[model samples]
Structures are given as structure tokens and as C-alpha cells.
Target chain A: MKISIKRQYFIEQLNHCLKAISPRTTLPILNGIKIDVSDDQMILTGSDSEISIEITIPAEIDNEEILEIEEPGSVVLTGRFFVDIIKKLSGDFVDLETTENFQTKITAGKSEFNLSGNDSNQYPLLPEVNDADSLVLSSAVLKTIINQTNFAVSLSETRPVLTGVNWNFNKDNISFTATDSHRLALRRLLDKTFNTEISNAIIPGKSLSELSKILTDSDEDVEINLSQNQVLFTYGNMRFISRLLEGNYPDTSRLFPENYETKVSVNNSEFYHAIDRVSLLAREGGNNVIRMTVENNNVELTSNSPEVGTVNEAVNASAIEGEDIKISFNSKYMMEALRAIQDEEVTIEFFGTMRPFTITPSESSEVVQLILPIRTY
Target chain B: MKISIKRQYFIEQLNHCLKAISPRTTLPILNGIKIDVSDDQMILTGSDSEISIEITIPAEIDNEEILEIEEPGSVVLTGRFFVDIIKKLSGDFVDLETTENFQTKITAGKSEFNLSGNDSNQYPLLPEVNDADSLVLSSAVLKTIINQTNFAVSLSETRPVLTGVNWNFNKDNISFTATDSHRLALRRLLDKTFNTEISNAIIPGKSLSELSKILTDSDEDVEINLSQNQVLFTYGNMRFISRLLEGNYPDTSRLFPENYETKVSVNNSEFYHAIDRVSLLAREGGNNVIRMTVENNNVELTSNSPEVGTVNEAVNASAIEGEDIKISFNSKYMMEALRAIQDEEVTIEFFGTMRPFTITPSESSEVVQLILPIRTY
Candidate 1:
């Protein structure tokens, strides 16, 4: 491949492409990024068996020439070194040329690099997905959905299905849920609709987390195509494909309690800070458990480590209803849930001292976080 | 201690004091910070056997009351936990009271902490240093001296003396030098004299690094007292004591080359960036060595990893003198020396292809960095 491209533009595309190249890939070819040059555009592809990212840079963009292709060819270059070289080259434009022997020469300003390249044909082919069954959602909305629930996914591999976020689409409403048995996070979007039949998919939380990072924050729609075992996301000039976990996700709809014995509404920041301080002592105590007691208009949080110290903090709640209750739970889980609320005020509903409790944003009911109390007799 | 102090003001003092507490101290008491409160002021002290820091927060400063002493007492609290609690407390003022049996109560806003404290009498006393023989230097100057030479110190404990920065005050000049036997960094200040006899001391680079962080950037003089085995630095309302490295530091004055076969002047940034990029290949090669060849006004830098690739960069020098020469050296050492120069234009003097070279600012002679060339076939 022979091409001349803007350094800044090339660096941006390379960053997105490198995300798919995993550091511990067993296949040596997966450690390299494949670049294909043609008369109309250049396509860069990076993959690590499970996820692949391909981006296209057109010959001209926004009435400005972005690339000039002298010859059409292909080569695979080591991803890490290629990215670092392009970033540090001191020039406005970079020229890349591949020889018949698969040797690539990269030149920018007065700096020149010659790297041994692998045959592009050796790279794995991207999985093809039929577009007949597809769903569309804005990149911004998709990113928010992933961020709100991905953290609650199980980090252990004992139950592989729980390590993924379960997505269910019905009629015009879509819901995303993730659970680790101890806690659960669910987010629902009411306005999104699918043109195809109802669909359900379990996407690895790690994959969704990586996808969220590469997706733009713009309102442009991202077209997603689903197959029997893989999913494809197409946005702008980039295509991201990830494999779906092969298993049935446990039903979590029954995890949310239908009734509450106590409810407390408190300012998010005030309550968050109080728990954060108490967690310091809790963390030292090995279990990271803190007790929360509500009475009238006051909520008291307490944690202690015999060797370190004990902390007691009281934050005023906006309102309290139902019976007063005392509950003990892992402070870390509560803190993570509170951070994901993204609201000024949050309402927490408790069923008793041992049952799971749910926290919801005071302004919206689309997001819910549920936590199981720890027994600390 | 029984005292009501502003949280911000108290946190600042606590941070400075905690710097001396080491996490892996054999003596448990050394891991705690001692708080001694008197009618006039409250002193916070932390020690790790190698270094000790004592900071005093006066009851009043600049005609403004910063602390109110309700009762006079002393207690030693766990350093890490104490700092964390104070930082997270949401209050303008914090009240600390020592109860019977050494239990301490800390109250701020609606947050209260009860910590088991040790008897202050168990803490080691600060070493008494005679002020009869002392040297004074501005904190800014000391900080600059540490920054310029500390990076060159040996990180390995094979040679204990080389792990410290050697300070020699003689006549009307003071010189600080550090070397790991591969490269040497020396900084000299002229026209600065001391009131006592000339002295030589080797201060551990790690201790100097911590001292530099706690020292103010102002030009206020920092009184340094030299004892047989320890050094004391007093500034404002703080006293810092550090144990001196007991060994003879190798004299580095003879290491600087007296003559040169080649001299090159180049823009500091240009040279630095080129070396940084070329080093990527050198690092992958396992030796991290790069070669530089200079003739006339052109300089070429090249590095290669047989399995990875090769990079060659050419930069134009402002001027080149004497015979043409080619030298290979560790790129990391060269990059660090160039960064320490802090000058727009730098002059590099080379003795031969294998001898050591010196880098210094084009306009000043106060600082010099000498690097030993690596032999590359």
C-alpha cells in the first residue's frame, strides 16, 4: 500500500483501530493492524479474535483532501510500534509505502521507519452479519446505557452469563440489565424502536465497556446488526464487531422488590460523601460493611475497624416515609450505585434489614440500582 | 490533643508530617503521627527512623487565629487513617480531643470518629542538633539543586554512596553531584558562602526528594544543621531531620572531559524529540542504545531492533566544530540529561567516540550533565 495522509487524522484513526488489538492474543497475526489502500479510500482493521474494529478514511473529506493513493496494496504492521511512531513523528503529513516483500517504509518530515510487515492475507476475516435483523440507536444513548449498568456485571467467570449485560427489546421499549447476584443495575429507554422482530442478546460487559469508549458522543445513529452469535455496530466510517456469549442469561425481572417498608429521599452529594468517609474505616475492617439507620429526618451511617477506628456520620434527608429501618451492606457497592445515579436527589427504598433494597433517581424512573444487605450479627 | 483547628489549615500540616511515615517500618510506633498540643501551638510529627518531620501549627498567624486550644495533651494516631479522615470531613473546623486511656475523639460538622491512640511518650524523640555549625540556603535554591541532579542517582543499593547526592560547601561555592557510574549530573552555585567551617555531607536522594516536596518555593532561607550522623533542615515552623549516608562519595570533578574532539549546538527541543522517537526502537532492541553521527551542520540519529524495525532521523544543528565523530549512548540517559538542562539552546561537548560527553546550557555554566558513551558494534 502506498499512501500519504495527514498525521493528525491518521493518529485519530489508529487509536480507534488499536483498541481491538489485545495484548495477550495467542495468534501472532492478531497483534498487527491490517491496512488496505484503494483508489477511493483506505481501510484499517484491528482484531483479537473476539472483537474487530475497521475504519475507513476517504480520499477527500469535508471538501479537503485527506489522502492520496499512488498504488493499491495491503500490509499488516505491528500495532504498538506503528501507533507510537506516528504519534511522535514531527510532521504534518506521513507517507507509507509497502514493497512486494511485505516490507513497509514510513516517512514523516526527516524521520523514516522501515518495519517488517506480515502478509495481510494471513489475518482472520471479519465475521459477516445479515443486516435484515438490525436495530438503530444514537451513539450517545448507547454509551449512557452501557455506563449505567455495566459496572454491576459479575467479575467472576463461575457463571459466564452473568459477566454480560442482557439486552431485551419489545415493541418500542428496550431494557438493559446487569447483575452479580449481590447487586443489580437496570436501565430502560422508552422511545427507541426496532424495525425487525423482537430480539434478545447477552453482550460481555467488557466488550460494551470498550465500545462505549470508542463511540462518539454525537447524536448520530449507530446501526447494529445481529447474527446467531455475533453483533456488529456501524457508525460514521467505522464498524465494530463483538461476539456474543453463548448462554441463557438468568432472569432478573423478579429481583426487584414489589413493596417497601421504608423509603428515604436524600441529596445525592450529601449522602455520597457521608458513605465515602465511613467506607475508609470499613475498608480497613476487611469486609467493607457499613450500617445505615434512618429515623424521622436523619440518616446515620456508621463503620468501624477495631484496630483502626470507628466513624459515624449523619446526613439530613429531604423526606422519610414508612417505618424506620436499619440496614447493613457493603459500602463499595452502595458507593458505585450512587455514582451511577447522575441525579441531584435519589430515593432509596428498603424492605427490611436483610432483603435487597432499590435506589432510583428522584427525577426519573428509567434507572434503578438494587443492593443486597450483608448479615453482620 | 485538645484543639479546634481549621480543617484546611490542619490538613496542610498533616500532609507535610505524614511524608515521613513509611508503610513498612519495623517499629509500629514509627508508623503513627504524634500530635502534641500546647497553649501556644500544636506540633505534628511523623518518623520512619530514616527521616522525621515535625510541623507546628501556631494558635495564631498573621494576626488571625487558626486554632483554639481547649486543653493541653498529646497522642499518637495512625498516620494514614488520620489523614484520610481529616481530608474527607465536611466541616470548616475540626475538634480533636484526647480522652482518658488515650482514646481520641475527632468531630467535624456532624461526623465523629473515635480512634484508639497510643501514648505519645512511646514516640521517638527528634534528634538534637547543635546550631553552632550550620549553613543556610534559600528553599528555592535547594529545591532546584535537588531536581537537577536527583534523577542521576543510583537506584540500586550496590553502592550506597552513589544513591545519595553529595553536597560540598567550600570557599564561596556549593556543588551538588549525583552519579550511577554511567552518567553524572553536577550543579554548582557560585558566590554563596557559609558562616561556619567548610563541610561535606551526603544526603540520600529519596530524603532530598521528600524534603523538596515539603519545602516552600519562596526565597526564605532554610537553616540546615549538620550533626555527626544526621542533618536537620529548619524552615518557618517546621523541622525536618534525615539520617546521613555513612560513606565516602566518589569525587566526580575528574570525570568531566577537559578537551573535546567534537562540539555540537542544537535546539534542545528538536534534539529531545528526535531521540525520544528513535528510542522506541532502541527500547525494543533490549539495549536501549542509539547512535549519533555529526559532520558539518547535520546530525543523524539511528536505532534498530532486528525483529521489530529501524528508525533513522536527521536534524540540522546550529553549528558543528572539530572533526566528525560517531558515538552510541543510552537514549534514556541522554533524554533525561537534556530535559534537566531547561535551556532553549544547549551545547554538547564530545571527547571521543567512547569517552564521556558533557551537556550544558549555551548561555550558562552553572549546571553540567556528563554521560558515558555505550560501546555498540
Candidate 2:
């Protein structure tokens, strides 16, 4: 197999695929990137067992010659070293040729590197998904949905299902939910079209992270097809696939409270800063608990560690309703929830001292974050 | 103690002093910064036994108000927490007040933080150095000298002296040398005004690394005073004192030979890239040794792992003389020394197959790097 491609354009696509390749794969060939060249396009594939990314470069882009295929073939090369060499190679065009003995030669300008290649047949094949069960959503919405909820997923392997974010789709809406038992994050987007109704799946948090980076923020829509064991997201010429966790996700809809005795609205930045300062002192303590006292027009946040000292800060609030109450919760969870709010002002609701509370944007009911209160004296 | 200072300016000085403060200190007072407010200036000090830094903020700079001293007093505050709070404070001017009970109030904008302060008498005093044995050099030259030789120091604690760089000053020139015993780097500068003949002293590589970041590449001169146990550098209203490592430094002047059997000249960038590529394969093999063979005008660089096959590439040399020879050395050491040369083209002088060779810029003899050859079959 022999091919010559533009260095810059080829390097860009290789970088995206490299994100899916893991350095600690037990199978030696799984640590490589598989390359397939055909008469019309060139395909690059990188995967670990959990996630796989494949990108194709077409024959023509803006009437420029990108790839010239002398022969159609496939080969797998070391992903880490090959990417470094290509990025640092000083030339406009790079030439790749593979011999029948599985020896590959790479040349650009005056520099040439030869590396041993593995048989492409050794690489795992991607599972096929039916197009009829595909769903369509804008890239911007997809990235936001992942970033907002993925961080709340549990990282421990003991509870494997909790390590993945639960995705549920209806006729025209998509909902994402994640929880570590201590805190929960949920986001919903309406107007997304889905071919199937009321389907639920648990996708690993790690795969969503890699997918978030590859998705563009443009208005272009991305196509997603789901199967019983795998999910595939196709954007332009790139195909991203991930293995789904085999378990039923816990019901998170009941975790958020339906009503609250007290609610307070405050500037998002001011409230975030107040919690940030209190966290410095609480972080030194064992439980990372910070207390909030709400009054008529002022909210006071305080935390103390007997060994270190205490911090007391108060910020003006937009409005306070019902009975004034004091609530204590994890400072880190509140900070993360406040940071995810897109609006300038946020409204926080409290049911009781021990029950889970809810925080949402002032005008939007689309995103809600819940944190279980920590009992403190 | 009572004072009001511009928040940004105070934070900058605090940031500089933070370099000397280590997170974990056996003596509790050493982890705190000493703040002294006098009638004329405000001083901040941070020390960790091996190194100490003191920065003074005068009452006025260019007829501008920088510090307002309301009362004269001194106190020590925890370095780690103080620096963080000052950096995140939201105010243009910060008000600092110390109570009789030793609790200090730091007020900025609408936020207030109260931290417990310690007695200033508990902090260690800075060492004294005589002005009679002082030398002056521009910050740029001092910084350059440190950068070129610091990378060659040994990181192992087995040989304490080898972990520091040796500085030698004679009647007309000053020189710096560092080596981990495998390779050595030496840089010399001729300054006739620096006539004091001082003995060699080894300064810790870690101290020099911190000083390099504080010193700017400007024409401003910094004063260096050498005493029996310590070295002091004063510049821009700041004094930096570092304890010198005690031991006799190894004599490396005898490492370089007066003559050579072969000499070759090559472009700096081109040679660097060739060695970089060859090292990729060599690193996988045990010692990262790359062999070079010179036959008249053609020079070939090769490396073989036996299991991973072999790579041979020819690089163009502008000049080659004497007999044909093949030698092997660690590619990493060769590349580092080549990068330190301050010329477009460098000349390498080889004494024999087992002896160490020297690489120097063709245009000047101010800097030289020597690497010992490895035994390869």
C-alpha cells in the first residue's frame, strides 16, 4: 500500500482519532491506529475496547489534491510515535508505503522514518448500527449536554452503572442524568428528533468526554444511532462509537424535590465567589460542609474549622420568599452546580435541613442540580 | 500593625517571595511569611532554611502612593493561605490591621478574612554577607549562564556536591560548570572589571532554578556577594540569599583534550532533528545509544535494537578531516549539548573511540559541551 497526503490536513484528523487510543491496551495491536486507503477516500481508525473513532478524508476538498492512492490496502502503525513524527516532520507532503512484510516507510522532505506495522486484520471490527433508529441533534447542544452532566458521574468501578451517564429520549426531547449519590446533575433539551420513543441507555462518562472534544460548536447537526450494546455518533466523515454499560440505571427523577419551603435568587457570580471563599476553610475540615443562612434581602455563607479558623461572607439577594431557613451541604457540589448555570442569576430551593435541595437558573427549567445535605453541628 | 496597599502590587511581591516557602516545613514559623511595617517601607519575607527572599515596598515610587503606613508593627502570617486569599481578593486596595491578640483582619471590597498571626521573633534572621567580596553582573547574563549549565546537574542525592553548579572566578574571567559525571557543560565569560579572585563555590541547582524565574532578561545589573556559608543577590529592592553547598567540587577542566583525530561541522537544527528521530528507537532499547559513522564527506547516523531492526540515515557535513571513525553515545546528552551551542553551525572534536568528545560553536569558544562515548558492539 502506498499513499501521499497533505501534511497539515492529515495531521489534524490524526489528532482527533488519537484521543480514543489508550496506551495501556493489553492487546499490542490495539495500541495502534489502523489506516485504510481506497479509490475514493482514506479512513483512519483508533480504539480501545470501550471507545472507537474513525475519520475519513475524501478525495477532493476545495478542488485540492489531498490523497493520491497508488494501491488500496490497510495497515496498523504505532499511534503515539507516528503522530509525533508527523507533527514535527518539516515538509508540505508526507509519503507512506507499506511492504508485504509489514514494514512501513514514512518520508517527508529530507527526513525518513521506518517503523514496524501490524496486520490490520488483528484489529477489532466496529459493531454495525441500523440507520432507522438514529436521532438528530445540533453539535452545540450535544457538547453542552455532555459537559453539564458528565462531571457528576461516579468514577469508582464497584458501581459500574453509576460510572456512566444515563440518557433517556422521548418523541422530541432528550434528557441526561448523572449521580455519585452525593450530588446529581441533570440537563434536558427539547425539539431533538428521535425515531424511537422512551428509550434509555447508559453511556460511559469517559467516552462522552472524548466525544465532547471532537464535536464542533457550529449549528451543524450530528447523527446518532443506538443499538442494544453500542451507540454511534456520526458527524461529517467521522464516526464515533462506544460500548454501553449492561444494567438498568436508577430512577433519578424522584431524587429532585417537587416543592420547597424557601427559595432565594442571587447573582450567580457573587454567589459562586461567596461559596468559593467558604470552601477554602471547609476544605481544611473533614466533611467539606458549608452553611447558608437566608434572610429577607441578604444571604450569609459561613464555614469553620476549629483547627484553622472560620470564614463568613454575605451577598445581596434578588428576593427571598416564605420562611427563612438555614441549610448545610457540600461546598464542592454547590460550586460545581453554580458554575454550570448559564444565566446571570440562579435560584436555589431548600425543602428542609436534611433533604436534598435543588438549584436552577432564574428563567430556565431545563437544567437542575441536586446535592444531599451533610449533617453538621 | 495597620496599613493599606494597592492589592495588585502587594500580590506581585507576595508571589515572588512564595518561591522560597515550601509547603511542608519542620518549623511551623518557616511556613509563614513575615510582614514588617515601618514608617518608611513595608517588607515581606519568606524562607525555608536553604533559601530566603525579602521584598520591600517603599512608601513612594515615582511620586505615586503605593503603601500607607498607619502604625509600625510586625507579624507573621501563614504563607500558603495568605497568598491564595490575596490573589483571589476582589478589591483595588486592601486594608490590613493587626489586633493586640495577634489576629489580623484583611479587608478588601465587601469581603473580610481574619487569620491568626504568629510572633515575628520566631522567624529566622537573614544571613549577612560582606560587601568587599561582591561582584556585579547584568541580570540577562546571569540568567543565561544559569540556564545553560543547570540542566547538566545530577538529580540524585547520593552525591550532594554534584547536585550543584560550580562557579569559579579568576582575575579576568568567570566560568560555570555542571556535570552528573557522565557529561559536563562549561560556559565562560570575560569581564575584566571582575578582578576579585574567589575560590569555587557550589550553589544548589534548585535555588538557581527559582532565581532564574525571578530575574528578568534586562540590562539592569544585580549585585552578588559571596560569604563563607551563603551567597546574596540584591536587585530592585529585593534581596535573595541562598546557602551554599559545602564540599570540594570535582575538577572538570582536565576532561577536555587539547587535540583531536577527527573534526566535523554540521548545521545545528539539522543535527538536532536527526538525533531526535534516532533517539525514538534507541530509547526503547536499554541505554538510548545511537552510533555515528563518518567516512570522508558522508556521515551516517544509525541505531539498531536487533529485535526492532535497524535504521541508517546519512546527514550532510560541511567539513570533515582526519581518519574515518565510528563512535556511539547517548542521543539525549548529545541533543541537549547541541541545543546549548550559540551558533548556526557547530564543530565536534573527537579524540578517540573510548575518550570523551567536545562540541563547540564554530564562531566562538565561549561555550563547550562534552559527552562520554558508550560501549556498543
Candidate 3:
């Protein structure tokens, strides 16, 4: 296979594909990026066992010959070093050619790099998915969904199922939920007649994170396809396939308390900053717990470490209802929830001591964050 | 200690002094910052065993009251938590008052932090240095001297002396040299004079690195005092004291080859990038060794990794002198040395196989880098 492409364009696409490449893989060929030159375009694929990413570079772009396909063939080359060499090559265009013995030659200006390549036949083929059942969503909505709920996924390997984001979709809406038991974050988006019914699937949180990163600064619509054990996301000229986690997600609807004796509406920034300051003392405490006491029209966040002393922060807001109750919870969980809240004002609903409370923006009660309070007298 | 100070001013000063506070210090007191309040001003000091930094916030800056002192006393508070709390506090002015029992109160806006403070007597006092043996040099020159030689200092604690930068001062010039045996970097500055005879002192590389970072963005002259076992640096109401490394610095004068059989002059950026590209392949081989073959006016950098293949880069140069030669050296050392060279053109002088080579700016020989060649047939 032989091809010549514009350096900037090739590097940009290579960077996105490189994220899916594994630095270490049990199968040696899995560490390589497979390149195929066809009649009209060239495709680059990089994968680990969990996810695979592929990008296609068209043969001609804007009347310029970006990729000149001399022969129709394929080869798999080292992912990391090949990407680095291409990026550092000081030329406007780069030429890549592979010999019959799987030796790949890369040339740009006065620099030339020859890398040993594996036979393309040895590289595992990505599962083929037919375009039968697919869902389309704008990249912005998809990104927001991931960012709002991805942080709550459990990082523990002991409960592998909880390490993935669970996506549930019905005829009219899509909901994403992730929880580590300590905290649960849920986000839902409305759509016009989603083709699939109430189907639930879990995508590894790490794979979605990489996919979100590669979709940055793009406003195009993304197409998603779910299969028996694999989910495919296609956007622009890139295709991302991730293995689905095979397990049942814990039902979190019953965990969020519906009744609240006290509800406080506070400015998001003000509350976030106050908790941020109080967390300084909370961090010194053995348990990073910060207590929020709502009395009359005032809200106070306090943290105490006997050895280091204590911190008290009072923020004035519009009215507090019911009993003047106090609840202590992890400051980190609250901070993360506040940061993810996009509304100017957030409404926090408290149930009782030692129960999970809900934090949701007043504008829309659809997205909810539940934090389990710690009991302390 | 009771004082009310502008939050921004206090935070800025704390940021400087906080550089010397190491959270990993074994001594508990060393992890705290000592605050001394006087009727006229307030001083903040933080120190680990190796280095100490102190900054003074005057009562008034340009007739505007920045600090209002209610009492004159001293106390020590935990450095890490205090710095973080003050930075995140939401107020323009911060009120700090110490109770008779030594508890400290910090108030800013609606947030208040109460931290147990230690008696100032528990804090170690920095060694006093006289101004009689002091010299003044622009922060720019001092920073340049540190950057040019500090990277060569050995990071391994095995050799106590090689882990520091040796400063040699004469009546009219000062020279700084650092070496880890594998490579040596020497920088000299003229027009800087000392009242006494040549004074030699070795300051820990880590301390110099911290000092250099503080000197960044400052162009004013800094007064430096040399004592028996410590060096005092004073600038803009800030004093930095570093414990000097005690041992004889190796004599690096004879290490540089006086005359060379081969010399090559190339654009610094060109040569650096070529080596950088070749090193990508060389790094995979083992210790990142790249070979340069110089003949006449051209130089080719090549790296071969049997399993990964090879890379060849040709860099343009002005001229080459003497016998044709091929030499191999660690790419990292060459990259660091080239990065420190100030001139656009760099000249490398070589002796023969397995010998050390000197790299210097083509225009000036004051700054030199010597790298030992690696024997690879």
C-alpha cells in the first residue's frame, strides 16, 4: 500500500484514532493501527479489547489529492511511535508506503522512518453491525449526558457492572444514570419518538470518556447502534465500537427520597464556592464531611476537625422551609454535583437524617443528583 | 497576633513563602507557616529543613492601608490547609487574630476558619547572614545561570555533592557548574564582582530550582549573601534561605577537551528536532541513544531498533571541519544542552570515539555543555 496525505489533516485524524490504541495488549497485533487503502479512501483502525476506533480519510478533498492510493492493500503498524513520528515530521505532506515484506516507510521532507508492520490478516476484525436500529443525537446533547453522569460511575473493579454508565431509552426520551452507591447522577434528554423501547445497555465509563474527548468542538450529529453485546457510535468519518457490560444496573429510583421537610434555592456559584472553602477544613478531618444547616432564611456549611479546628460558612438565600435541619455529607460529592449543574439556581431537597438528598436545578427537576448523608451528632 | 490585611496581598505573599513548605516533612512544625505580626507590618515564613522562605506585607502600600495591625505577636499554623483556605476565601479583606491561648481566627466575608496555632517558639529560626559579604545581580542573570546548569545536577541522593549546583565567584566574574559525571553543564556571567577572593559554594539543586521559579517575571536586582553553610537571597521584601551542600565539587576544568579534531555548526533548532525525532525510535531500543554521522557540512541522525526498524534524519548546517566521524550519545542530554544554548547557531566539538564532546553557542564560548559518547558498534 502507498499513499501521500497532507500532514495536518492526517495528524488530526491520527490523534483521534490514537486514543483507542492500547499501549500494552496481550495480543501483539492488537497494539497496532490497521491501515487499509481502497479504491476511494484509506481507513485507519485502532483498538483494545474494550473499544475500537476507526477513521476514514477520503482520497480527494477540495480538489486536492490528500491520499493517492497506488495499490489496494492493508497493513498494521505500531500505533504510538508511528503517530509521534508523523506529528514531528517537518513537511506539509507525508508519504507512507509498505513493501511486500510488511516493512512500512514514512517520509516527510528530509526525515524518513521505517517501521516493521504486522500482516493485516493477523489483526482482529471489528464486528460488523447493520444499519437496522440506530439513534441519532446532536453531539452537544451526547456530551452533556456523558459529563453529567459519567463522574458518578464506580471506579472499583470488584463490581464491574457499576463501572459502566447505564443508558435507558424509551419511545420519547433517553436517560443516563451512573452511581457508586454513595452518589447517583441522572440526566435525561427528550427526543422525537425514539425507535427503541425501554431498552437498557451499559457502556464502560472509560470508553465513553474517550469517545467524548474525541468528539470535542464538533457540533455534528452522532449515530449510535446497539447490538447484543456491542455498541457502536459513528460521528463524522469516525466510528467507535465499545463492548457492552453484561449485567443488570441497580434500580436507583427507590433510593432518591421523594419527601423533603426542607428545600433551599441557592445560587449555584455562591454555594459551590462556599462549600469549596469549607471543604478545606473538611479535607483535614479524617472524613471529608461538611454539614449544611438550614435555619430561617440562612444556610450554613460547617466542617470541624478537632485537631485543626473548624470552619463555618453562612450563605444567605431565599427562605428555608419546615424544620431547621442539618445534614452532613461528603463535600467532594456535593462539589462535583454543583460543578455539573448548568442552571444559575439549584434547589436542594432534604429528606431526613442518614438518607439520600436530591440536588436538582429549579428550572428542570429532570436531572437529579442524590447524596447520602452521614449521621453525626 | 491580630491583623487585618488585604486578601490579595496576603495571598500573593503566602504563595511565595509556601514554596518552602513541604507536606511530606517529618517534623510537624515544618509543615506549618510562622506568622509574626508587628504594629507596623506582618511577616509570613515557611520552611522545611533544606530551605526557608519569608515574605513581609507592609502595613501601608503607597499610603493606602493594606494591613491594619491590632496587636503585635506571633503564631504558627498548618501551612497546607491555611494556604488553601486563604486562597479560596470569598472576600477582599481578611481578618486574622490570635487568642491568648494561641488559637487563630481567620475571617473573610461570611466564612470563618478557626485553626489551632502553635507558639512561634516552636518554629525553627533561620540562620542569620551578614550583608558584608553580599553581591547584587539582576534576577534575569541569576535565573539564566540556574537554568543553564541546574538540569545537569544528579537527582540520585547517592552523591551528596553532585546533587547541587557549584557556584564559583571571582573578583570580576561568576561561574556556575553542575555535573552528574555522564554530562556537565557550565555557565559563566561577567560584570558580576565580589569584594573578597574567589568564593566557592554548592547549593542544593532543588533549592536553586525553587529559587529560580520565584525569580521568574522579575527583572529587578536581587541581593545575595554567602555565609558559612547557607545562602540568603533578598528581593522585594522576600528572603529565601537555602542550606548549602557541604562537599568538594568535582573539578570540571580538565573534562572539556581543549582542542578537537572535528567541529560541526548547525542551527540549534534543526539539530535539536532531528535528534528528537531519531530518539523516538532510539527510545524503544533502550536508553534513547541516537548516532550522528558528520561529514563536511551535512549531519545525519540515525536510530535503529532491531524489532521496530530505524529512523534517519538529515539536518542542514553551516559547515563541518576536520575528519569525518560517527558518534553516538544519549538523546536526552543533547536535547537539554541544546535547549539551554542562547545562540541560533550551535557548534559541537568532538575529539574521537568514546570521548566527551563540548557543545557551545557559535558566538560565545562562555556557556558549554559536555556529553560523553556511548560506544555502540
TM-score of each: 0.97, 0.97, 0.97
Considering chain A alone, report the TM-score of candidate 3 relative to the true chain A. 0.96
lDDT of 3 by residue, A1-377 (tens): 88888899998988888898777778888888899989889999999978999999998778987887777788998888788888888988999899968999999889999999989998898987655778888898788888899999999988898999998875677778999889999988755445654388899999999988977655798999888788899999999999999988888767867778889889999999999999888888777899998876678999998898989998877546776888999999999999878999999998877778889998896689989888887
| Candidate 1 residue pairs in clash (backbone atoms < 3 Å) | none
Q: Candidate 1's residue-wise lDDT over B299-363, tens digit each? A: 89999888888889997788889889889999999999998887899999999988999999999
Candidate 1 segments exceeding 4 Å error: A195-198, A295-298
True contacts kept of 2: 0.18
* RMSD, one per candidate, in order: 1.8, 1.7, 1.7
RMSD of 1: 1.8
In candidate 3, list every pair of residues with a backbone clash: none
Chain A, candidate 1, TM-score of 0.97
Instruction: Assess each model's interface with DockQ, reporting 2 decimals per model.
Output: 0.82, 0.47, 0.87
Angstrom error of the Cα, residue A82, model 3: value is 1.1
- Residue-by-residue lDDT tens digits, candidate 3, B1-377: 78888899888888888899997899999989999987798889999989999998898899999999888999998887888888998778999899976899999989999999999998988888776867888898789889999999999998999999999876677889999999999998777667644379899999999999999656898999988888899988899999999988888888877779899999999888888899999997777899999876678999998899999998887888888899999999999999989789999999997899999999997899999999987
> For candidate 1, lDDT tens digit of each residue in A206-319?
889889999878899999988878889998999999999888888888888877899999999889999998998898778789999887657899988888778899878888
